[model samples]
Target: MRATLIPHVPETHVYPEAISVEFEREGGLLWLRFIIDDNPDFIAWPGDAPVGRADELWKHTCFEAFVTTDDGYREFNLSPSGQWASYRFDGYREGMRPADEVCVVEGLDGGRDYVALEGRIELPVEPRRLGLSAVIETVDGARTYWALAHPSDKPDFHHPDSFVLDLP
Candidate 1:
């Protein structure tokens, strides 16, 4: 399958990058790792705040990820009580439950559609490390990665006219 990076913002500021996923297993437990190159840094203003703001920020990033990828991917938040959150491509507001064992996400807007294949992944018997590459298929069947500018670099979410994705 081919992957394409669809910029969530405009073409002026964001740069597209490559994304990969690595999986590991130990004692029948599975561990998944996401490797994103040039991943934008999401900063929370004031450093700390009430739960409302925190939730808002999380939702904002989630939306950003959804739009940028056209709802083709999902993210897992590492923060406490915020684990395994899944985002879908059609729209996150549709209220899709996260996987019990894995967090799944898709783009908010209708991202390019591709068939997801099912297969078994093998890891090292003694905590072996496994890395699985994530392939994003564009509407035209091209593989690509999405990248965005850091909020601090632009400081204006109102005008996404500056964001861009560097496509491979």
Candidate 2:
């Protein structure tokens, strides 16, 4: 499945022209892709820095996925710097724990005008819904939030209504 992520607020867009996330289920793994369309000189992406599983990647430029099943949900943060993290929430912002059970592989593709992140994770159950989002930080230290759907007036990815992508 593929969907375009729109900025939470139109007036707040500083750098990115477009952002999107796509997912493909293969065997027991889910391959995810995030694309950011922007001028290289304009966006402040963390170039080819080494990244590991860390917290608060969202403080900068990062790609995110909120996967929801029947029991709970998992939040995956994938950064261009090669760092990634996953958190399991029993409910909305409840029982937060490091989802270290899933191994993730992330990398960059393409160049200046457009860059893409390819990530793969072991998904044991089919997701019921997904909230795809991104936190884009510009060279001037401005941040913009993008998501598949912005149900609230503010940028709230955790809002239950943000899970607009219903799966089959």
Candidate 3:
């Protein structure tokens, strides 16, 4: 499945024309491909680093996925800096703890006008709904939140209504 993300507010610059996330389920693994289109000069990306787990990657340019399970939900933060974070929530923003499960990330790479992230998130269960989003920070220290759906007036990815992607 592939979906485009919209910025919370009207875009003032032409840094990025669009952002999207793709998911493919195969061999008990759910693969994620996030693409940021028309990132002029690639100024928003923080550059590459050693691939590993880290915290608060969302503070900068990053990609995120929220998968709802039987009991709770999972949040995966994939950063362009080669860091990733996975957390499990018992409820809507409740009991957030590091999932500690490692995901296979190929590292964030980009071209002249686009950036992409590819990774394999372990499928804990068959997700029925999903919230795919991103936090983009430009070289000028400006930030914009993007998501598949913005149900609230503000950028609230945890809102139940934000999980607009229904799976079969």
Each prediction's Cα lDDT score?
0.28, 0.80, 0.80
Q: Which stretches of candidate 3 lie over 4 Å from their true place?
A: 12-14, 40-42, 47-50
Q: Write the per-residue lDDT of candidate 2 for residues 82-136, one digit (tens) a residue.
A: 8888888889889999985464756878786888888876553757887889898
Ten residues in a row with the worst lDDT in model 2? 99-108
The parts of candidate 2 lying over 4 Å away from their true place are 47-50, 124-126
> The CA-based lDDT of model 3 is what?
0.80
Candidate 1 residue-wise lDDT, 1-168, digit = tens: 222333333355432254433333343433433344442332121232222212232332222221223432222232212322323322323434442223322211112321121221121123211112232323333333233332434332222332332211
Report per-prediction Cα RMSD to one decimal: 15.2, 2.0, 1.9
The superposed Cα distance between candidate 3 and the true structure at residue 119, in angstroms, equals: 1.2
Give each model a TM-score: 0.27, 0.89, 0.89
Instruction: Please rank every candidate by lDDT, starting with the best.
Output: 3, 2, 1
Model 3 has a clash total of 0
